[model samples]
Target: MALEINMNNFKEEVLEAKETVLADFWAPWCGPCRMQGPVLEKFAEANPDVKVVKINVDDNQELAMQFKIMSIPSMIVFKNGEAVNCAVGLQSKAALEELVK
Candidate 1:
């Protein structure tokens, strides 16, 4: 399972991390976000080198706004403390891998 992140730990878990980070911005009420969860878990299991985390928009409104997350199931790939790529929608395990690569 992907680690659940909030504003409190966002910097330590993602920004300061040495490895690539994949941050999934989502809300529990969103159907597509719910669907994306399992896929993200599978991706995390398959890709041990990458760090996978989930940010609940409802719980972390500040983070959601900071990232400009207008859509649920939005994915942002961070490397060296900077956002490198972004995707919005339900994503397959293969597609998730592609985002990190």
Candidate 2:
């Protein structure tokens, strides 16, 4: 399962995580976001070392604003508490692995 992150706890949960963190910024009503869901799940399963998180734009408005998430399916990967990679679209598991790697 994906850990939920929001502006209220983003700093503590994502920026302060000890390991790599992958944040999927999405919305429930978005078609593309729904399509990307399974891919994210697979990525999370394959990368247990990385903390995979989900930030719903509807539930976490502040986080979406903070991240400037204009897209429905955006992903930000953080390592050592800093964003190292970002993807803004539906992505394959292989593509995410390459970025995270």
Candidate 3:
């Protein structure tokens, strides 16, 4: 399962992670967000070396606003404390793997 991230713990878990971090910004009411959940879970399970996180927009509104998340199911890939890439829609596991590489 992907780690649940929030505004209170964002700095500790994501911003400070040493490994590559992939964050999926989602909301419970979003259909696309629901579809992306299992993908992220599977991806996280397969890629143990990388950090996969899930941030619920409804719960973590502050963090969502900080990242300018205007849509659900947005993914932000971070490395060395900086956001290197972002995908703002439903994406295949292969595409996500490519981003990790």
Query: Quick one: best lDDT, which candidate?
Result: 1
TM-score of 2: 0.92
Checking candidate 3 for backbone clashes, the offending pairs are none
Per-residue C-alpha lDDT of model 2 across residues 16-88, encoded as one tens digit per residue: 9998888999999999999988888889899999888999999988888888899979989898888899999
What would the per-residue lDDT of candidate 3 be over residues 6-36, giving only the tens digit for each residue?
8778988888999999999998899998998
Off by over 4 Å in 2: none
Off by over 4 Å in 3: none
Model 3 TM-score relative to the real fold: 0.94
For model 1, the stretches where C-alpha displacement exceeds 4 angstroms are none
Q: Lowest summed-lDDT stretch of 10 residues in model 1?
A: 36-45
Q: List per-candidate RMSD values in Å.
A: 0.6, 1.1, 0.9
Give Cα distance to truth, residue 1, candidate 2, Å.
0.9
Ranking by TM-score: 1, 3, 2
CA lDDT, every prediction?
0.95, 0.89, 0.89
Instruction: List, residue by residue over 26-46, the lDDT tens digit for candidate 1.
Output: 988999999998899889999
